[model samples]
Structure formats: structure tokens, C-alpha cells
Target chain A: MIEANTPLLRMVRYFWPMVVLCIGLLIIVAAVDSTGDIILAQTLTEGLVRMVMVVALYMFIGNSGIISFGHIAFVLIGAYATAWQTCCPYTRDMFMPGLPTYLLNNSHHVVLAVFLAGLLAAFVALIAGFAIMRLSGIAASIGTFAFFMALYAAYGRWSTWTSGGSTVSPMEETTTPWSALAYAVVTIVAAFFYARSRWGLALRATRDDEIASKAAGVNVFGQRLLSFVITAFFCGMAGGLYAHFVAAITVDSFYLKMVFITLSMLVVGGMQSLTGAVVGVVVLSVVIDVLRRLEAGIGSFSLPTSSAEVGVGLIMLLILLFRPSGITGNAEIYWPFKGDISSSGAMKRQS
Target chain B: MDYAIQTIISALSLGSFYALGALGIGLLFSVLRLINFAHGDFITVGAYALIVPSSAVTATLLIGDFHPALLVLCIVGIVVMLAILSYFVVFQHAQKSSPATMMIISFALGYTLQNIIVMIYGGRPKAAGIWSDLTGQVQISSGVSVQLLQLVTIAVTWILLIALVLFLKRTRVGIQMRAAAEDFRMARMLGVNGKNVIALAFILSGGLAGIMSLLFVTQTGVLKFSMGVPIMLFFFIATVIGGMGSLVGSVVGGYSVGIVSVILSAILPEELRGFRDTCVFILVIIVLLARPQGLVLTKAAKERV
Candidate 1:
């Protein structure tokens, strides 16, 4: 069997398609980065950052088929953590007087702060996942939503550690299209490797048939918890990227609207494929950009404001109606015409 | 004591809205496996019905000028029509899709409805002047008082709940609905009309939403485009904690949340009061961990995933 090949051979074969895709994406981002238009740069950075989040979303949801509502919570935690580490030391102390003296006195490098932000979020996810992963089906989803709300509430009022509901600002503006592109590539690769891992396969099997997988020795809860934490780490880093890019942070930015927009991207892209995640982000980002332009009026033919959201809603409906499985229909865009070169192949979607 | 009675009345008053919302969402969910996220939109549209758009930026009383009963009836009728129209135009086409697809479709539909509301009423919260008489407070004993509207809310909610109970138990269509909720495909094979049952569910849910919105705006005295979001969140929590498909469970869960919220607000230090909802939701997660089937286990929910 093609899947029965040697380990090294299988790894190389799996690597073939993902590397090509990542390189292709990198080239596109580089071209966009070269455009030198500030608005285009802003949109490109936004799209790439979102791509990181959607990819993280795909890592867990694509494998487990659970639509998580709390990944954005990690983004929130990460941004705040990054804000703590990278905000101006004087303002940090003035605003967040509760931070330890060391953090209040010294600002860390932005890159290192980002990594620490991800670690903190991953740590929180690990603890939370233990309780959460025990639940299956809609209960698990609702559990995540609960976790999200709890975290948001706690942070919103932790006035000494945060600016409370106010914006956290005066730090860094380090995220560029190039840096965001790099993060997106790294996230995509991580998601690809994670999905191709034995743990990912075990999780997917549980998703497909939990009873059958349990009989076959899959630790369903553990697998789910693992994926959940991994997704949290990526989302945390994505949030870190977002904070540095915007040069400001606010708790509200990572709330319900962000949750819906990111989830919509994953669903529109198809929930089961890496290609779907990236493709969904790019397509929707471009559509939103166009709609935003239209809303601003391109030479007296302007549409109403907030019509972009309507356009997104409508496109999502049409996608769900015409392609219930999403634009990718649960299939990864592999190296085409090579005829199933690696294992995993096409997903046997029971949805 | 006066304190005890006041707390109970307040608890019931808040619980009424939650129970109504949970009933609608749970009913639709049981029959179709669709969470019907657009139910919130129905509530919002019903609230906005009191004041039709006078201009793009402002609204004036239209049918709200009618007698209170007729005004209420007119709002319920409009929401029901919206529900029926959505079923025909959107949900009917996606009948064969997955629960996830149906849920997403409902979300998008909700988004569309919210945008439409914003387009008509603008994003500001409007000071609605309906049932102003109910705003008056009622004194029961020394140091004991409650809003007259709160009592009316309790009365209206219970009356409606009783009516729904009777309808579900005694009517032919209601029995068909219960059968469909139990086992949709089997019920269909046994000659239950899937389309008709689903349509009836939408109607009942929409009417409940109408009533719930009325009670909601009457108490709050304000309406915003996104007002439904928070109400829907608690309704979702109630449905889940109550047990998704069980009617009594939904009502029980709603009251438990309401009572617990009031208790928490009363008991917690002022600093922690802001976290009352967070605390309730965390408790929900714990309950799920202990009983994923919910507080009231259902025969259908017992099927292991």
C-alpha cells in the first residue's frame, strides 16, 4: 500500500505537497509585500494574521470536527500577555500596577514576548482542556464558549493587571506582512504535521466513530485535549502577532465578533482541510476588501456602510447552500494529478 | 421575610425571559437538530416592531398605537410570518444538510437580519415607551417592593407555559411534534409530515420570541440592534443546562440560572459581582463534565457520541 511505505519515504512524500503550497503562499505574500501601498499592506498583514488563526483552528476542528468557540480566548490572553511584556515600561506600571516589579521595570524583546505569550496560553489551555475534553458533542462546544466568557470577564475586570476595558497601547509596531507571512507559513506547516501525526489520526477516528475508536484503544479525551492545547498555542501566537501589528491592544477586539469572523472563515474554507483554511481566509479577505472599497464609494457608486458584513453573511449562506461541506468539500489541495501519493488521502467525511 | 420574597420575585421575573427563550430554541432543536441562531433575530425584529422606521435614523410608533393586546398580537403575527418565511426561503432548501451546516446557515441568517435591523433602526438603543403603566412598583409588605411589570412578566410567562403544556399534551399537531422530536426519521416513516411539524415549531418558537421580546423591552425600556445577543447566550446556556430536548428541564434550568444569578449578585463581594455570568457558565461546564446529558437526562441524549 502507498501508506505502507517506509517512514522516511512517507515523510518525504507528505512533505512534497505541503512545501509546494507553503512556498506558493510565500511567493504571493512577497509580491503583496512588494506592492508598497499602505492600505494594501494593512490588508495583507490582516489577512496573513487571520490565516494564522484559521490554520490553528483547522488543526483542532479539521481533525476533531468540533466547532470550538474559545480559541479567540487564547488570542485575547496572548495579546494581553504581549501587551504586558512589550508595552512601555512607564505606562505598564502606571496602567497595570499589579504586574510584578520585573515586568513593570523591563520590556522583553517582541519575538520572545510573543513566544512567552503562546506558552502561557498553551499552559492555560492544558489545564482547561482536562475539564473540557471530557465533554463530547454540543456540550464540549458550549464548554468552550463558557471558558471564553469566563476568561473575558476575568480579564475585563482585572484592572491592576490590565487597563480594564480600556485600550493597552504605546508598545510596538513590529508585525509586517513579511513577518506575518512567516508566521502563517510556520503555522500551516505545524498544522500539516499535526494532522499527519498519529495523535491527529486517532482524534479524527474518534470524530468519525467514537465508540469504534474507543474499542480500538483510542484515548479519545486525551487526543482531543492534545489538539485543543496545540490549537491554543497557535492561536496565542496569532494573537501576539495581532497585538504587535496593531501597536495597541484592547480586550474587546478579541470578543464575539472576532470569534464569528474566524469561525466563518474556517467553515467557508471547509473545516477539514489546511488548504481550505488558507483559501477561505484569502478569498474572504479579498471579498471584504472589495466590499469595504465599495462602501467608501468608488466614484459615486458607493454602497452603505457595514454592507461588507452582509456580503460575508450572504456568501457564507450561498457556500453552505451550494457546497454544504464548504468550498473545499473536505478535500485538501494536494499536488494535483499525482494520484494520491501519500497516506491519509481523501478524508472519508461522515458529515 | 421581605428580602426572601423580593429575591424570589426578581428571580422569577428574570427567569421568565430565559425560560421563554429556552423553550423556543429547545423546541426547534429537538425537532430539526438546528440550533436556530436566528431566533434572536426574531426577538429583535419583534421588539423593533413597536416603532417602525420614521426615517433611516429614527423610528416612530406605528402599530404600537393600538390597544396593548392588539399591539402584542400584531407583533407576534409579524415574527411568526418572518419565521415561516425563513423556513420556506432558507431552511427548507437545506433540509438534507448536516447540523453544522444548518447552524451556520441560521447564524448567517441571523447576521443578515441584524444588519437589516441596523439599516432600519440604526445602531442606537431606542427609548421605547410601551406598557409604561407596568413600570410602576408594587409594595407587598414593610420594606418589600417589586416592579408591577415583574409580576406581570411572571404571570404572562407562566400562563403561556401552561398553554404550551396543554397544547403539547392535548392537541394532534402537538403529539406529532413530540413524536418528531423523539425520532425524526422514524416519525416521518410513521407518516408524520416533517415539513408541517417543522413549520409548526417555527411558528410556536416565533410566537414565544414575540412574547419574550415584549417582556424584555417592557422591563429594560430600551432596545438596541444587538440586544438579542446576550439574551440568546443565556437562552443557549439554559437549554444546554436544562437538557436540550426536555421542556420541563429547560424551564428548570432557566430558573436555576436566574436564581443563582440573583443569589450570586447578592452574595458576592462587589468586586466579584461583575463575574456572575462567568461564574454561572463555569458551573455549566462543571455540570456538563459531571452529566454531559445535562441536568435532566433525556432518552435521546443518552445515546453516546
Candidate 2:
């Protein structure tokens, strides 16, 4: 009886895989860094940024059973927010003179700027989700997309702070592989905790059966909005990570391409679990990196430019066709030390 | 009044593209219960059929230089065939997937198709004018001066719209398609050939897209890989706002989008006009907030997994 699995232990069990995966990723990044593979390290760092982005995506999408294209908008806000805080005042003044007087005068520590960026993004998401969360199903999905388009259009043309359509470059590159991995790990932990939270349970219940959830007295809109804000915060932080990784930002970077890439990662990773989000980003990034290398000329074989996109799209289609739920089959990483799958299932069932 | 009439004339022409594209998308959505992002690429395919496939700077017309009737027929036939082929090749196997999965499949398929176009044609926008004379302006009435193509567009759209309505009301295959759209399982259990009806809807939509690409290319006078994307976006929005399941609603939604675009472009100051899409999308969000089922719905939108 003393050894029997408890809910608190089961929760910890659910949380461990992300920490393990992050450590594994950190080891890989360190090994690549030690080999002096600049390109490889940079690519892995970019992959880490995507990990944060996709996992952030999974928070709202996986738990709430809503597919959102708008989270990238939050990411865009974060990236720009990071840009404002970290840019050299002279360059920013010349390029983005529309920032507030304080933001114009001061440079923030990287950690504060990034977290504030997330907070800003989450605040914005709260407002957007308030307007959007009333609807259920497909309308909500399209509503999110509409929000994405609107934000993009506004940002693309609003030349005041963003420098409008031009790329803001050569500012800073504070997002190294180590930092990106840290962000990824943080996002995964945050998403895991949220998923295990009561709001996540209610949101997921609404996902499974909306009317039933309503009858069960769940505040469906509130739960969806809460998760939307939570994911938005993480995605915004990812934007900060991305901004510094490239040492640059553009409205286009956070456009349809990013939306598609991150959404595909979430969906391909199986959208139902934290592990799927991480796995999808890693798998897709590796595949993209390989294709890019091959396209750039790996000895005798060279593919056409943009072949990576086609290849990834084809691979996604094939994977989705074969396994509609995703590669993980919507399951988490099993507890390898013991046959804990049954016990975990039993605990969740009881909970 | 003259300025207003002039703007409306232009809006009517643009709206015609939305109407056709919306009809195509709406037809497919009804049958499949999912949006097909690749339908735009289907339009692109038909438009690209006008020229010899090449990576050259300027395009030389192939079937495009043929008699107008023959060219239209050829392109429509090609697109219809492509639509039917895509179903069998890609979507047929994906029928059991959720709406979200299916939408992603369509997005992936579109991405592949667009890249393939880039691979074949290169990314440069090539000048490909099928009918230069259509670009000429004509005096329509005492008040308004408009392009000849505008009049042609308005006339053709009304004709197509009426013809489509008649076909849906009177034809057996059309009725079967409608029945299947209403309730696929019930229709299948009854007498409708589900596969055939779905295929027919695809054909109708494909043919409509073909005609739209023609008009679109004629007006724009340039051919590019992503030529169909702008129209596809509007039509997709139209599918949602107008009503996913209702044909009339699709048309209404498409025209609404077109009119809004034109009006916004005209009204907004120069620096702010580029963000008209932002405004249009804001309206769409508001619309969804007010009416989650769309402005009109013959039936409730299908459940998403």
C-alpha cells in the first residue's frame, strides 16, 4: 500500500520526460559546440527556438483541442518587444523611432526583456482570446487565423517602431544554443504543468465533448482563454529567443511560413502530448537541415532550391496519411524503469 | 456619383473573381467537409496551362493563343481533370481524417504544388497576356467609364451564378451532390452515389476555377507561381463568413469580401491603405464572434476532431 502510485507521484512522472529530453538535447548541443561546428550549432539553436515555439503552440492547441494560427502573432509581438529592449539606442532611434520614450532611452537585461516580452504577448493574447473564445470548433480556428492575418497586416505596415517592411538586423545575437535549450526546457515544463492543471483538464474535457463539459459546469471559454494566454506567453518568449538567435527580425519571419512550420510540427508530433511537440520540431528540423545541406551541395548530389519545403510537405502528408494521430500516436514517453503505463493510465482514469 | 460608379465598376470585376473562387471552394468544402488550400494551386495550374512551361524571362503562349472558346474549354477541361486526379491521388485516401488533419493535408499539398510550379517555371513573374484587347476601356453608360473586361466579368459571373443555381435545382447529379452535402451517410444509404456526387462537385468547382484563372490572368496581365493565392485567401474567408454549407452564402461572402477590399482601398489614406487586409480580417473576426455558424447555414458546420 505504501508503494502504491499516488496522484502527486504520477504528476511528477508526467513531468520527468521533458526534463530528461531537455538534458539529452543539451548534451547534443554541447557535443556539437565542442566539435566547433558553427553551422551545426546554429542550426540546432534554431531548432531549439522552434522547440519553444511548438511546445508553446501545444499548450493551447493540445489541451483545448483548438488549432490556433494566431499564436504566431503573439510570437511576433515578443520578437519585436525583444527588438525594442535589446537594440542599440542609436540604431533603434534611426530605424524605429516610434518606440515609447523609456524604451527608446533604456536597454534591458536579456532575461527581463525576454520575460516581459512574453508577458506582453500573453496580455495581448488575453484580449484576442476574449474576443475569439466564445465560438467553438472551426469558427474559433478561423477566428484565430483572422487574428493572425490582422496582426501581420498591421505590423507589416506600421513603420513607426517595426521599421515597417524592412528587416531589423545586426542588432544582437544573445540566443545561443544553451539559452535556446533553456527556453525550450522552460516552455516544456510550463506546458506540462498547465496540461496537468485543472483548467487544462476542463479545457480538454470541453475539447472532447463541449456540451457535456458545459453540462458539467465547466467554464469552457475561461479555460480556453487561460490556455491561450499561457501559450501566447511562451510563444512570445520564443519570439525573443528567435529574435536574438538570428540577431534580426522581420515581419515575414513570423508570417505564414512560420505559422505553417510550427503548426505542422505540433500536428506531426501528435498535438495531444508535450513529447509530440518536441519530437515534431526536432524531427522536422533535422530533416530540413539535411535537405538544406544536400541542396547546398553534399558532394555529387545537389537538389534544387526550396526542395526542403516540398520534401517536408511530402513527408508530413505521408506521415499524416499513415498515422493520422501523429508519430507518437498521441501517447507520452513511457516510464521505462517500470511497466508504469498501466498504472499511469489507471491514475488518469481515476483522476 | 461618377467616382462612386467607377469604384463600384472595379469592385464588381474584383468581386467576380471572389465569387467564382468562392463557388469552387464552397463546392469542394460542401463535399469534403474541409477547406482545400490546394484549390488555389488548381487555379494556378489552369492559368499556367496558357503558356509553354519554361524558365524563360517572357512566356510564349501555347494553347492561350488559340480561339478564345477553344482556350477556355481546354483550360477548364485540364483543371477539371486535375481536380478529379488530386482527389483520387491525395484526398481519397485521407477521407477518414479529421477536418484539422485534412486542412493541413490541403495546405501541404498546396505548398508542394507551389514549389513544383517554382521548380518548373522559376519564381520570376512572367508577362503572359492572353487577350490584350480585354484590357481596353469602354464607355458603359452616361455616368461611368469602365474596362471592357469589367463588363464582361459582371455579365459572365451572373450567367455562371444563374446557371449554377439552375443546375443545382434541376439536374439529377446536382441534386445528388446537394443531398450528399446535406447528409453524406444518409444520401449514401439512400440512392446517391457518394463518390460520383463528390467527384461531380469537384468537377464543377474545378471548371469554375479554370474560368476564374482566365479572367484573373487577363486583368492582372502577369503570371506567377502564387497567382492564385490572393483569390484563394478571399474565397477561403468567404467560405467561412458566407456559410460553409450554403452555395448562396459562399457567393455572398465572396462578394462581401471583394466589396470591402475595394471600399477600404478607396477610403483609407495612402499610408494606411496597405493594411486594408488587416481591416477585412478584423471584420471577419467580428463576424465569427457574432455568428459562429456563419451568416447563413443550410446545416451546421461539421464537427472538428
Candidate 3:
């Protein structure tokens, strides 16, 4: 191992570039909003929420080298938690008569609801991670997916709390462009710091070689569970933001389609780096937005709107075929005139 | 006794559908270590191949109007060709990637295929009455009646299962494919052609998907863009529960899931009936936790780590 630096300095050294990129992207969104483009602003806000969720995913998957199909379960939990706390008590009582008096009688500010959402999601993750993180490889993946299915089924049936499969609408639409940007920045910074922490290094070590890491005295399960819970927290926050952004919460929104889209973003950006997570979300979101506009016949040479969906899949496939590691391929964009830094190498030296 | 017999018949028929799907998934997983999320799309393609391409609410029979045997042949042929093409074009390029990456690629491929179908047929579900005779009830006992489709489904499943077993046991190509499934690199070094074995697996899997689609579409009588997803999801879960690389395990896993699903739905209370899926998944999680390697443990099921 290279010489050790203080944790604070090491975090700055490792994550300064990602921090700068997040701030820069937020500034660009803010600039676009100032030009009175409400649609663009709304889209950016949606993109920012996705950014938080994707980065949250990266926090666990990137460091631990595990692909989770069920992180969206946390998102579901978060969204519903927000809905439970923030929806009008009258509407909540009408739609969800099965809810307890505490939840049915109360409403909270968006910030507190969002926080509680994250906390609830984190608690669920704590329970699930204990069971799931014990198994490795594909079994673990399936286990998490099963967990997701159970949550989905429960949400769908336990109508008193989730409103079943119907849309839970008229949520407090509090997630503006600025708020989304703030959440994105916070998630990015948290992800960066978590990934650079000692547990993060330990988790990656275990991911590289579980047996070897165990032999080297690493508490692999503990590290994995910690990362899992932390990532779930941020994912839940994103879910809360999403519920407010769309003014609706539905179980369908947090199911297979969302899972695939976010996973694709992570893979396309570079599943191994924080920079990749942010970059992937921005690039794909912009591409999708442009395609949507084109599909709406914005251009003289317009294609059918359905083709836009096809375009996203094809582009992702081509990218995976050409660059399986993702657009950044484990590298981060450094300061002006300096070369890109390979995160793996930087991580090795830091650890 | 009559209710029990009916439940048994339903369970068996449903299990056949899942078993066929699981076999397809298991075959691919054995050779390529890929979950092949697009396998379900192959089923959808098979279903759609019977219908004329149109935007009408009701689809006209394309191959469905043909003689039964010819129709089966045509649907299977189209699905098999599409499967082989996909393997060549998409999977061949990512042959050496990690399982997670390959799975994502397959998902994208499925997404693309589903969208193409949407563009061609429009998003409205189309009704096609193919083999409506299969929908008739057959009374096996004085008081028990079952759908002819259920018996037919079971018969088809057993025939295919027996045929597959025989082929694997008796044929040189079957042995070679098994060898490849066991260890591709080792089999290649031992003079088995990797491409041929992998291609054969894909073809067989595609044929199974085709058969599954016919049975499913005949049962439901409606073809939607995402019709294959639920079956595929169950198949995926079954494949994992049975054991990733074991053929017999796949069949066993399929039946387990099917039986549990049928039983849960049958017994669930009115208000809690919606939670039948939750119960099924809870059972799956319990099974997984009990035996992480699956119900059948193969050498490949053991993780190196």
C-alpha cells in the first residue's frame, strides 16, 4: 500500500473532480432554467433525481461489484413514505383507510418527509441486506430480486398503505430544479465520501476476491451491509424527490422499467466510478430528451415517437458492445490540462 | 376429490409452461452463463408471428389460418431463426464479458424487440382465436372438468422433456453440448466445437420459447407487447430455484413455483388474495436462503469465491 494520508485529505484528493462536475452540471441546469424554459427545467429536475438514485446505486454496486436489481424497492419505500407523510390527511384517509391514526392524522414538510423516507428505506435495507448479503454471485442477485417482488406484491395488495397499483396523485410537488440539484449534489458528495472511506476500500477488496479478503481479515459481510444501507438511504431520498417531482407515486414507476433504465445509465456511464455515474445519467437523459423532442415532430425529418424507445436500447447496446466498461471506463475527468485519472489506480494508492 | 383433481390439473398445466421456459433459460445459462432476459421476447415474437402485421384492434390470422402442424412448424422456424440471429449479432460480441454485462445487453435486446413489435402492431392488444377448440372442457371424472388445453399442455411438455432426455443421452451432438455446458474452455480444448454447441442450445431454447408462446397465447387468446414478461419472470425465478446449470433442476423448480402459485391463489382469502404473489416470493426467498446453490447443487453452482 502507498503511504497513508488523513481521511479528509484523501477524500478530497479522490473526489474533488466528481464534486466539481456535479456543481458544474447543476449550474448549467440553473442557467437553462433562467431562460424561462419550464419544460427543460422540469426535465433537468427529473434527470437530477435520477442522478441521485444512480449515484446511490453506484455507491454499493461500484464498490462492492454486485449488481442489484432491487434497489428500486428502496425507492418505492421512500416514495410511499413521503406520500404517507405529506399527502393531505383527508385524501390519505379517503384512499388509505387502513393506515394507522398517526400517519392518517399527520402531514409533514417536504424536507422531513424526505428524510423519513430515506430512514424508512434504510431500515428496510438493513433487514434485507442482512439476509441477502450473506449470499454472493447470482444467488444474491436473485435474492434481492425476490425481495423486490415481495415488496412490489405487498405494495400492490396492501392498498391501505400503497393505494394498490393505482396512481397516488397530488403529492406535494416540492421538488423544484433547485431542490433536485441540491439533493443531487448532496448524494454525489455522500457517494464520493462513502466510496473513499475505509469500508468502501474493504468492500472493493472483498469484491475483487472474497476469499482473499477474508483471509486478510476483512469483515466482508459487514462492509457490504454498510454500503447497502447507505446506498438505500440515498435511493430512498431520490424516490421521495421523484414522488414530489411528478406529483404522483405509483408502484409501476419503481418496477422493472425504472430498474433497467437506471442500471443502463450506470453501466453506460461506467459502473466503477463516481464520475461515470454522473456522466451516464446526464448523457442518457439529454439523449432521451432530444429523442423525445424529435419524436414529437420538432424537426422536419421526424421519426415516430416509438422509435425513440428503440433508439435508447440500441444506443446502449452499441455502447456496451464497443465500450463494456462504460463511457468513462473507470477514469475521472481531472482539472484543466491534466490527464484523466484511473480510479482503480487512485483507489489502490489511497488505500 | 373433484376440486383436488382440478387443482392438480391446473397446477400441472401451469407447471408445464414454466418448465419449458425454465429449460430454455437453463440451457443458455449452462453454456453462456447468461440469464438471457430476451428469451421472453422470443416467446412474444413467436406469438406475433401467427398474426398479420396490422394496427387493427383485432389481428388477422397469418400463419394461424394454416393447418395445425404447418402452423407450429412456421412459428417455431421463425422464433429459432430470430434466436440464432440474436446470438450471432448481439451475444457473439459479448461472449467473454461478465454475466451482469451480458444480462444488461440481453435486456436491451429485449427492449428493442418489444419496441419494434410495438411500432409494427401498435400498443393495443390483439385478439386472435387460434385453436379455440383447445379451450373446450374435458371431463376426466364424473364431477371434475379440465380444459383440453391443460391436458394438451401437459402432453406437449412430457413429450419434449422425454425427447430432450433421449437426445442428450444418445446423440453425439447432445454429449458435446453437455460437455460445453460443463466447461466451455475445457470442452474446446478437448475438441468440441464451442460455436456449434452454443448455437444448438440457442436453437433448442428458441424452439421451447415458440412452444411456450403457442400454449400461452392459446390460453389467454390475447397478444400484448409485454405478454411474455410475467412468464419469463416466473421462469427466471424457477431456473434459479432449481439450480442454475442443472436441466432436471430447472424442471423441478418450474413445478415447485407453479404448484405454489396455484395453491396460494386458490387458498388466499378474498381481501388477501392480492398478496398471493407476495406469499410465492416469500417461499422463494425461504428456499433460496435454505439452499443458496439451489435445490439441485451442481459443480457449477458452487461459487469460486
Query: What is candidate 2's local distance difference test score?
Result: 0.85
Worst 10 residues of 2 chain B by lDDT: B296-305
Taking the tens digit of each residue's C-alpha lDDT, what string does model 1 give over B1-305? 88889988998888887888888989888888787888888998998999877434445778767888899899999999999998888888888876666776888899888877776567778877777888999897879999999899889889999999999999999999989988888999999999999999999999999888888787787878888888888888888888888878788888877778888998999988877877987888988888777788667667644
lDDT to native, each model:
0.85, 0.85, 0.87
CAPRI tier for the interface of model 2: medium
lDDT of 3 at A298: 61
Q: Among these predicted structures, which one has the highest TM-score?
A: 3
- Model 2: lDDT of residue A205: 92
Ranking by DockQ: 2, 3, 1
Clashing residue pairs in candidate 2 are: none
lDDT of 3 at A169: 80
Q: Provide DockQ values for all models, in the order shown.
A: 0.62, 0.74, 0.71
Error of 3 at A201 (Å): 0.8
After TM-score superposition, what is the CA distance of residue B85 in candidate 3 from its true location, in Å? 0.8
Residue-level lDDT for A22 in candidate 3 = 75
| Residue-by-residue lDDT tens digits, candidate 2, A48-109 | 99999999888888888878878899989999998899876677787798999899889999
Q: Lowest-scoring 10 consecutive residues by lDDT in candidate 1 chain B?
A: B52-61
Off by over 4 Å in 2: A1-14, A339-342, A346-351, B269-271, B300-305
